[model samples]
Target: MPHADTLTVVHHDDTRTSYTDVRYQLHRDGIRIWSDEGEHALTDILMTHAYRQREARAS
Candidate 1:
């Protein structure tokens, strides 16, 4: 896990029928979470949700 510090979550979202992506993402590992699906898998989810929330607050 080289440069793991730089390997941040980047973003998260709650796309499931339950809790938000942020809550779910941080549930197990907090920030440095891993999935067999790959890096972008979770990061993309968080990224979308983060942007959505940002826009919502702006409006």
Candidate 2:
């Protein structure tokens, strides 16, 4: 699992992307995900652990 403060990136399209925060609900009904663009259901957010990666930094 990602750390609470970690920023998540979602690809909305081939040329569009969104950064979001994903958290579990207090009641455990489901997860909550949101970004500057908007919010969406956990089920609506498609992701894969195998595809996740850390951002590279320049020296």
Candidate 3:
């Protein structure tokens, strides 16, 4: 997975190149994760919980 500031070249060849933007956007009540599959919109509470969960696992 790529962080918000990281830009990745997901696909590249002779004729075409594709770059993936791993960034999140903050909104009034939620955050949005851009993806090729679909955009994931999470409320503030859920975003906080996800961050906490990742922190707990890292610790």
Q: Go through the candidates in order and give the C-alpha RMSD of each one to the true structure.
A: 13.3, 8.4, 13.0
Per-residue error for 11 in candidate 3, Å, reads 32
The clash numbers for all candidates, in the given order, read 7, 0, 0
Question: lDDT per residue, candidate 1, 1-59, as tens digits?
Answer: 21221132333454432123222233333333433433333324343122123222211
Off by over 4 Å in 2: 1-27, 44-59
Backbone clash total for model 2 is 0
What alpha-carbon RMSD in Å does predicted model 3 have with respect to the real structure?
13.0
The lDDT per prediction is 0.30, 0.37, 0.39
Off by over 4 Å in 1: 1-30, 40-59
1-59 per-residue lDDT for model 3 (tens digits): 32343322221232321224344566777655666656666553222211211221221
Better of 1 and 3 by lDDT: 3
* Deviation from truth (RMSD, Å), model 2: 8.4
Residue-level lDDT tens digits of model 2 in 1-59? 23223444333342323343433232233345444556545433333222224553432
Q: Tell me the lDDT of candidate 1.
A: 0.30
Tell me which residue pairs clash in candidate 2.
none
